[model samples]
Target: MNLALHSVSYAGVWPGQERLSLEEFIPRAAALGFKGVMLVAKRPHLSLLDYPSHQPEKRQALRALLAEHDLSVHSLAGYNDFTVGPERPDVPFWEHQIVYIAELAALAHDLDCPAIRIFTGYNRDGLSYDAGWTSVVTGLQEAARLVADFGVVLTVQNHHDIAVDYESMYQLLSEVDHPNCRAAFDAWSPAVQGLHGNELAAAVRRMAPFTAYTTVADYVALPRYRYEPALVNYVEEPARMLGVPLGEGLIDYGTFFDTLIETGYTGTVAYEMCSSLRDGGNLDSLDAYARQFQDYMSPYVAKANAGVAAATAR
Candidate 1:
């Protein structure tokens, strides 16, 4: 139950957020009392272009930088969609993504990170659900094989449209059937889907065995409406979710963490403010949000660790 902060929170991926380079971000994360960090493996951070597999020096430098702050890299977050270019079969998009992940795997190995977080494909128009599912399963199998030699595990997050639900994610991992492929489950998606109390606990327990990692973020839903001039009324639209500080939003991390611990999940729990936050995403706001996660989760992590220690003593 080690706590880590995601670099995306300060990478300015979302509008209004102030960005920080990996060099600057490391010290700040350490200062915020994180045991490790989950780095976004792209531009303004650890992009493959900047730290290519051929460039061992860059990887070593980054590793030394993290060590300088006495911090570890919990995981490297990668972006890929297995079903991209469904219409352009000749483009070899899946192969390209596989190679991209392979490179990230190499980078992770050099950085001493154990896992890399990736996503299944989003549903494409004209593509059957079964087709998308098969593409993701096979793609993950190949990616897992590619990274196996590097000793890096590929963690498929319960994100993207292919297998977002906990049940589907479990099925996806089972079908992939690779030793290196595992789950990177998160609380945000299940919370948004209206899972709470017993239901949320069930989902966590089901995924716990396969889950190698998880990320935490809190959000409040903002209801939307569309004006229908012809009817002279407002039509209800889907709600927009805005990120908030931990414990202040719709997510029930209390239940989430309790289940995780009960199921013997000793994996990293990363906090990320990956979207437009409630307050403006200035440096101050970002720092405060990151600190809030530390303040909130400290007790939970402490309790989990104490339980483990007590069990070992027995």
Candidate 2:
């Protein structure tokens, strides 16, 4: 249960976010007591274009900086939408993604990272479910084989439309059938889908074997209202969400972490503020929220570690 902060929090993609360069981000995370960090493999951080494997000078410099702060690259986050247009036979979208993953795998290897986070493709309209599922399975298998050479694992996060739930994710990993393919299972998706209590724990427990790491964030839903002029009434719109501190949101991380730890999960648990947060996304607010997550997660993480220590001692 190593606590890590995702660099995306300081990437400033969200409005009003106070951003930090990678140089500034590493030390800040160390100061916040993060044992490791999940570096986003995009611009405003470790861009694959900028830190290619050929650039040993840049990679070595980054490695030196990480060592200076006693921080590890727990994982590298790669953004890939594996779903491609079924109509465009001329397009090389799937091949392009495989190459992109290879590049990131090399980058991760240079930084001594063991895993990289990725996504299953969305189930886009106009494509058959079978086709999309097959594409994702094939893509992941290829990516796994490519990265296996570097001893890097591709941990698929449950964030997209395809293979999003526990059963589907487990099936996808099995079909991929590569030892380097694993899961970056998160509670957010299952919780949002109304899985809680023992149901949630069961899902976590089932996915534990393939789970390489887990990313954590919480959110509370805010219902929306729409004015209806004809009826002279307000209609209830679907609820939108804003991010909150770990335990304050509707997500039941207690059961989530407890199940993972019980199943012998000792990988990094990362915190990310990928959306508009409860407080403003300004620098002070972001820092406060990040620290709060660390505080809330520390005890659970400590308990897990203690259990591990006792077991090892025995």
Candidate 3:
């Protein structure tokens, strides 16, 4: 498995820190020892509208930058929500997203990226469970078809509301039915969902065949407290998750990665600092965390590479 740094780590969307441009981010990722990068297809990075089909110069510039940094374009992540606006026939949000995905697919092909990342929609009001599910399937199918022409696959990350768990993700990928549609399965969601040991391993095995990539991040839940006037006591609110270095968090990446490596996952393992961190989101902090991730993931990367090597020898 190749190690890639997702641009969102420094994009600063969550913590309100200043975002880094792709020009600055590419070299930083390479400096942090990332072999490749997953560029967020949004502002402060590479948006679809900014790098349209007609803009060969923009693509060329990005390619040149990647070469200068000695980095590869692992994937382009598109922000999508297919569940909302399910009842609005007059609105064109869904159509625009499909077109945007197709555009991103073209850009991925131009940059020699094999995959594009997307999210399923969050379950919102005005949409029934069954209706929301059908919408996701249809949207992904269309997106898959659009990208398939470029030989680019759509890897659905488990960040969204639909198809987050192992069983649902497998079912979603199977239902999409497009050869280009696959899962970007992550350990965080399954870990948070309470899967562990053989159960988690079995889930990983089930999604292994359809999984082309996985995003990794570690987090620890911070307990929250709220004052209650009626009871004259402080009530415990839900714990807020804060990002931390790999081994310091609650995620069981040891078992998670062991299962994936043994299953012969020859895909990219992306490290992301997506939430509020233990330290602030400054470049110094980001760089430190990023380097820590590479160090933490070294053994797993070795394991995955050895698995590939053994399979090839066979």
Which candidate number maximizes TM-score?
1
Candidate 1 lDDT, 64-134, residue by residue in tens: 89988999999999999999998989899989899999989988889999999999999989899999999
Evaluate residue 182 in candidate 2 and report its C-alpha lDDT on the 0 to 100 scale: 96
> What CA RMSD would candidate 1 show?
0.9
Candidate 2 positional error at 260, Å: 1.1
Alpha-carbon deviation at 73 in model 1, angstroms: 0.4
- lDDT by residue for model 2 over 1-314, one digit each (tens)? 78889999999988878889999999999988887999989999999888877779999999999999999999999999788766786999989889999999999988999999999898878888898999999999999999999989999999999999899999999999999999999999999889999999999988988998899999999999999999999999878989998899999998998888899998899999989998978878878888999899888889889999999999
lDDT of each: 0.92, 0.91, 0.88
In model 2, the runs with Cα more than 4 Å from the true position are: none
Quickly count the clashes in candidate 2: 0
**lDDT measured at residue 164 in model 2 versus the true structure, 0 to 100:** 92
The number of clashing residue pairs in each candidate reads: 0, 0, 0
Sort every candidate by TM-score, greatest first: 1, 2, 3
Which portions of model 3 show Cα errors greater than 4 Å?
Answer: 16-18
Model 1, poorest ten-residue lDDT window?
Answer: 50-59
Ranking by lDDT: 1, 2, 3
